[model samples]
Target: MAHLRDDSRGQLLLVAGLALALVFIGLALVVNSAIFTENLASRGETAGSSGALAARAATEANAGTAIEQANHYNPSAPVDAFNRSLRNVSTQTEALSATSGTLSNVTYAGHRNGKRVSGAIDRTNNSYTVADSVERVSGANGTRGLVFNASDLPGESTPLVVKVNDTTATGDRNSWRAQIWETTSDVHVKTFRNGTSASENRTERCSVPSSTANRIEVTAGLVNGQPCDALRRNDSGANFWFGNGAGDEYDVHFKNTNYTTGDFEMVVYSGGGPSILLTTLSDDAIYDAEVQFVYDGPDVWYNTSVRVAPGEPDA
Candidate 1:
């Protein structure tokens, strides 16, 4: 009986030892994950900043070439030439950076913008589609709307904001006006042409919900006009499939139909700027970019998006 009791005590001690060992192991794993996550965030920021700066450099260096090529462009036209030029610049920059300090597995997404002036690159085709964005116009006609690529906006959510400043008018335009709406399909837009009732001077704003459709349509008219009802998904003209409702890749557009004599700037934002462009992806237009970084140790990846416009710089 004494011997049996001793064995039972040994068994309990062994079980306790195993439990302690497991606790230590679990602690080590948690620490490792925390460290890796921190590394990813910090390194991702570095790669993103560097990449954005380099992209800016490349864009500046290649703008003239792109324009020169576009002057007589045909076939794939200037877009093909433009992309090639950007790729060349990105490749050179990547090589230089990697050798100097940038991360590896750093893909030179010299990925083509597919002639898109401003948009996010599709993972499927590697093309750009600008979404959840805003644009401003310096000078304009009675009708003009900036088009953004589509994204999946969460249902009944207003993750996007459109702000227009048409009040800065002079001469033949004393009355400032603005109108914003969305569309799901490519049909005739009537909000910003000939005669729209923006005769009163004011600033206009609206929140864009992800529900009701896949596209943001615009005509230049009343802020709450019948055409604007498309926001409700009740409009037969609206193609609700405009967005997938997945909470990514949602497109936002802005329209101005009454600013014919003065200057105006329309800002579309989910609440941010930079890492993007307005009309073209050249020179001063190369506003921001998304930099992808991969770390092999522990197998980690980080994608850092940076906008250089508001002064994000390396430390």
Candidate 2:
């Protein structure tokens, strides 16, 4: 009887050992699977982040190219340029993304120009998202520009504030002027040429700072019976009759007033639109400009804007 009991105990011990071994095998498989899952997740995150950044780069390049192309178009007319840019961006998006739907459409807005634009690029199984946009950055160069045509600001009675800052480039080439006239102010002229000069009958007159080193800040309003004045010029072309010669290059930097905005800069503001006076000095010579368009009632000007940075934007 004792020998039988011993044999039974041995069989029980062998069964328990087998069960323990099976449990260990099952545990090993679970641990291995967990590690593999973690590794895959890490890799996927890294790849997605990289792809998103790449997409941003592609879209930004496209945006900049569009803006340059737009710049060559009619500076007065911006819609055509915007359309052209949108088309180019579409082509760029195609190159950047695997699917058309994955990339976001390009868009733009501005008062006087298509100065600001936006878009997005997506990549890699939609694992991550990349957004891109571009803005017109001025002041990098030492020049500024603005325009106020016939249609920009219509009515003549609106008040205006004309401001000017003097630069060291005076006398021989320094030019700062404000032109004004009523029914007698309009001057009939043809295309501009070098040494363009005209003598207008006594009605509207032109004014420029005699002191090249002086700064000017004047507002034209219906104080007594006079409307606000603006940065004005009647003559066009190099060596204009209105001047001691040379173009009246005003700084078109409106927002920044520290006078540190550009190489030679000035800012002009007017409640009413600016009067029409073409740049008589029609040389390829670069000059800063500002334009105020008269839409419905209030005049509109192109607001300055910034573009996407090389780094990631804040969410």
Candidate 3:
């Protein structure tokens, strides 16, 4: 009887030890599983952050396109038209993102009013007024989206000169000018703070070696899609933007218009109406828009505000 009791006690002790070992194994498995779940969550958050930034960029691009379309097609009520377009963009973006198990959206916040003035610079050689008494956008001190598309520019002797005259001031000392011409192998844009006399005024020049340089984005500071120092912000106090240093309002005139052959366009923000020289393709167009973007993923949520101005100069 004593030997049987000893064997029973040993078996009972072994069973307790095995049970404790099993409990320890279960705890380890639980801890490892928790660590793995945390790692997956972190990875998901990182991917969501990247997706949000990409979505914001896409929203800005789409908003810019919407503004252009509204100005060109719904000039009478561009702001209202732009908002409608934004709604469609939001719906499309959300639907596309759903395929990736995410939600993204773009919502219109607001817009700035302006006019899109476009047309031939001049069919004849006669100089004429491009716009008169055009005021700068209320908050900003300059105009935007001023571009020249010249297919046939004359030589320096008869270059096309664009002048910006202060409404309340006159003379070479108070105006900004851009003289454009082309040579056998290059196209040139000469900017003047006040007058065309290079020795008497602050002047700078930008030239492109390609004979096919036709596009000149003036306010955006690009020549033939290349950066040009003459048209951009300069610390020397001479910027070629029409409204710069021109007071509250200015008149845009083309001197020797017959020197260049092409179309030009610009947008001015003001309460005044468009000049007859400009077709006023859009009376009350939206020049820029602000949008709110949102992105939602399994492990992250992001929201941001972006302003879309397609041709505004780089800050």
* lDDT for each candidate structure: 0.34, 0.30, 0.76
Better of 1 and 3 by TM-score: 3
- Decreasing lDDT order of the candidates: 3, 1, 2
Stretches of model 2 off by over 4 angstroms after superposition: 1-10, 37-41, 44-52, 64-80, 93-315
Candidate 3 lDDT by residue in tens digits, 1-315: 345588888998999999999999999999999999999988888877887888788888888888878887887788888889999999999998999899999888877667788877666757887777876655664457778888888899988887877877757656778887888887788887764344545778888764454888877788788877677656675565544555567788878877677888777765565353555433666766779999997768998888787777543
lDDT tens per residue, model 2, 87-177:
6665655544535224333444332322211111111221211111111124221222222212111123321212222222432233323
Cα RMSD (angstroms) for every candidate in the order listed = 18.0, 23.7, 9.6
Model 1: per-residue lDDT, tens digit, 1-315? 245588888999999999999999999999999999999888877756655455454444344344334422432454455456546655665566466455433322331111223233223321222333222211211112233333432121222323222223222232222233243422112121111234522232334333322344332221222233322232353221111111222233332222111112211222233233345432212222233433322223334332111111110
Would you estimate the TM-scores of all the predictions?
Answer: 0.26, 0.29, 0.71
Give the candidate number with the greatest lDDT: 3
Q: Residue 15 deviation, candidate 3, in Å? A: 48
Q: Model 3 compared with the native: what TM-score?
A: 0.71
Off by over 4 Å in 3: 1-51, 96-102, 138-142, 194-201, 211-213, 234-242, 272-283, 297-301
User: Model 2 — TM-score against the truth?
Assistant: 0.29
Count of clashing residue pairs in every prediction = 23, 22, 1
